[model samples]
Target chain A: MLRVENLSAWYGEARVLRDVALRVDAGEVVTLVGRNGAGKTTVLRCLMGLHAGQRGTVELDGRDIGRLPTHRRARLGLGWVPDDRGSYASLSVAEQLTLPPVLRPRSSAERTGLAWSLERVFEAFPVLYQRRSVPASTLSGGEQQMLALARVLRMGARLLLCDEPTEGLSPLLVTQVGDILRQAKRHGVTVLLVEQNLRFATEVADRHYLLAQGAVAEALDNSAVRSRERELLAYLGI
Target chain B: MTGFLQNTFNGLVSGAFYALLALGLAVIFGMLRVVNFAHGAFYMLGAFGAYVLLAEAGVSFWWALLLMPIGLALFGMLLERAVVHRLGRLDPLYNFLFTFGLTLILQDVVKSRYGVQSSPYATPAELSGSVDLGLFDFPTYRVFILVFAVAVCALVWWLLSHTRVGVVVRAATERPELTRAFGIDVGRWVTPVFGFGVGLAGLAGVLAAPMRAVNPLMGADLIIVVFAVVVIGGLGSIFGSVAAGFGIGLVQSWGEAYAPPIVAQTLVFIVMAAVLLLRPAGLFGREESAA
Candidate 1:
């Protein structure tokens, strides 16, 4: 389980994340939906400790991790998939997959199953296997996205903080990602996703935190989000 | 023609030093984004280490070669932890300036100890004579230096390409912050990498002791050329720096043979300027990763 309480963030003088609070229980997928500049990324950044200009309490499985550095947060099973599929141009696809050293899960509760082996990861994404020997930058956008997500999964990250993983991806690729996330959730991985596509959000996430101007505007379950989809889209200017 | 061949051999020998030095520079720069102005000082230290070992402790060239690099590597790691890493969050330029200041201090320390005079080191008895190349006879020691440097470079290259640690280090070099987010303790590797880079410089310095004058100012003049080689190769590209090192060596040799003294002196800078104009990111460099 992951929890954030009163997480206020700032980019210098300008505040980004207002006193925001949210939580994702184990094996659940939650989404934070917002318009452009609504601090969706900022919220993820703060959770990952990439943004230090903030005051917040981030707890992972009852242990306060707010003071940890990014790598320490990562050791606590915090995996980040930034909006841009972060891939090293110099590293091959296989190299990228194996770059992050597999660390033991910090909390016993967070450890659910075996981390994905190279063989398993290769089996999960056959296209990646086909192009494993090639540089990661040469992979198409969708392929790179798969690499990013698959890397964290292989690291056995208990909680994934994904920022707009579906953005700029083809619909087919988006569907593939949804399947991957569902598969991850089945294996006891919890996710805190930031997505703009509410329809896709409803399909994958059990609950949605509608983030507007850096604060949680509404906490809606799947049915509520579906009922208010049209109004929400218009207000989000999407 | 014999003179030409000998000069070519000399050029390649000089290039081996540059390649060794620049390889360290590129690795350090790639990982830390700091331009290590003290690289030459370490090179001088390598030579002086060999010289002093023989002079004070009666340690031989071979032993110095093995020990100097390792000793300096440990020293480098200590310095990084004790001083360099303290300013990690500041601008990268702070490290650059700090390294430059370090270089001056190192040079002065050596100068104070030995005075500005050149120190002599006897060539190893095994490598005292010349070996017959097809064109001309070359010094046995020069041949050993060439072969040794190339073998070391190849070993380093293979280690980087094939090892898991190498992949992680390479990935970290390419993307430091993102690598951390992927659950990598990139900081854990930084000190060792920095130390390894310094070791390479020290290794190059040990190689230089026999070939060049063992004076405090030896690295002062040579480092400028090595920097040019790095610039031509591309700032952070490891392979680029090595290629540029050897390439500049050959170019300078030919320039010295065929052209005037001033042209030979300016050849590397001219090539660097041309490379900068043609490929600003360097021959091997790509534009910033869109992360």
Candidate 2:
């Protein structure tokens, strides 16, 4: 449901994304796999129009979203979870959940079809419910990640762009996140995840694109990813 | 007992001004994240607008009160669009410096035009006389100022707490990106919100026109005290700003009444320093950086 072609981005005279191209069909989970600083996160940011200086064609269901601001893109149903979590320190877990509900598109069906409510999000991560009124800063890394996911889920977002969802979490929590991703797939949410973890990427990602030196070094479908493991490792230097 | 009542009444009256000015500052700072050095200038503009309406247009005090904020808000929008909006993505210090410079220019312009002398703003004919309090007599103008100030505060509180527009503004103040992501064109809101803040400042200035001196430097000294109020209120906390503004105003009034006049002006600063030393976040302020 999303197409990005010839997408190039830069950060202050340094070219980060060079002629990168990717696509995701409805209900598919796509992964951008790369080591630290492979321009994977930049791809998600550019797609969301978060990058101030981006040039390319980003189409969501055949509409040009390249020139739209981040908010405009969000209103158009693009949900972004940055690598930093982007949590407002002053907002409580509940406040953060309630925040973006006001920014959704003007469709009644969209609002009613929300499978992720405060209760549902809490069910997904019981710890979040326990600390619903607690401020974001006091939450642990795993809890913050859960809050981030819960927040996006609360947005009723059709497309999800998650950056390093498992970077700093414990292995146990990472597994829990993997389970959440599996659950998201069941709900028909398109996910574009940026990950350095091969096991984590393979666990949920339906298709994988290995990025190296600002270009896509390898594109492996879910089945091809397993057989081409050697090629992926060489590019990743894992 | 009479003296105590008089002091309390006096404190409340002054507190009203503090509350109104601080409220505007809080709103502006909350949305813009820039310390508005020109807030007092807007306040001064309101006084001038009131004077102009009364002297030139022969308008009543009530009409000037209503029209001045709207006018100043529009002017504030122009300033925000032309100046403050450009400062976005730059160091916040640039906006602060720019506002500080604007204040000097505005004050100088007003001074050149109007002269550095207090102008008389007559109390409205309807509320011109005093009502007898049980123990002492209070002027009708003072009562009007106090009651209208409270009403304005309540109106502001209602506008901020109850409205959908307020929700968007407050949400933007807390997290601009998230608010934007949620489909709020924060850029569109910035100009109006900034203008509204300046309008509030002008409203406060109009209110003060009858009560205090209306001159070029009228807002100058008060601006410093208002900054102290902002600091004591903790940057951009709305209710904190209101409470601190009034609380400090009362404290200053009490200090001026009981203590030596020489040290009375210093009392507000003392309270601010104490609040900073003890509860650095101000009374109602949240720890924004941590979140």
TM-score between model 2 and native: 0.85
Minimal lDDT window, size 10, model 2 chain B: B282-291
Clashes of each: 0, 2
* Candidate 2 C-alpha RMSD relative to the actual structure: 3.9
Candidates 1 onward: DockQ, in order: 0.78, 0.45
Which residue pairs collide, candidate 1? Answer: none
Best by lDDT: 1
- Scored by DockQ, the top model is 1
Score candidate 2 by lDDT. 0.84
Model 1: per-residue Cα lDDT over A20-66, one tens digit each? 99989988999999899999999988888888799988899899989
Shift in Å, residue A85, candidate 2: 3.4
- List of clashing residue pairs for candidate 2: A89-B291, A103-B182
For model 2, the stretches where C-alpha displacement exceeds 4 angstroms are A89-95, A101-144, A167-176, A221-238, B1-5, B87-94, B128-137, B260-262, B277-283, B286-291
Instruction: Put down candidate 2 lDDT per residue, B124-243, tens digits, no spaces.
Output: 788877889989999888888788888888887887666667667777888886677765688888888788889889998998888789998888878899899888988888888888
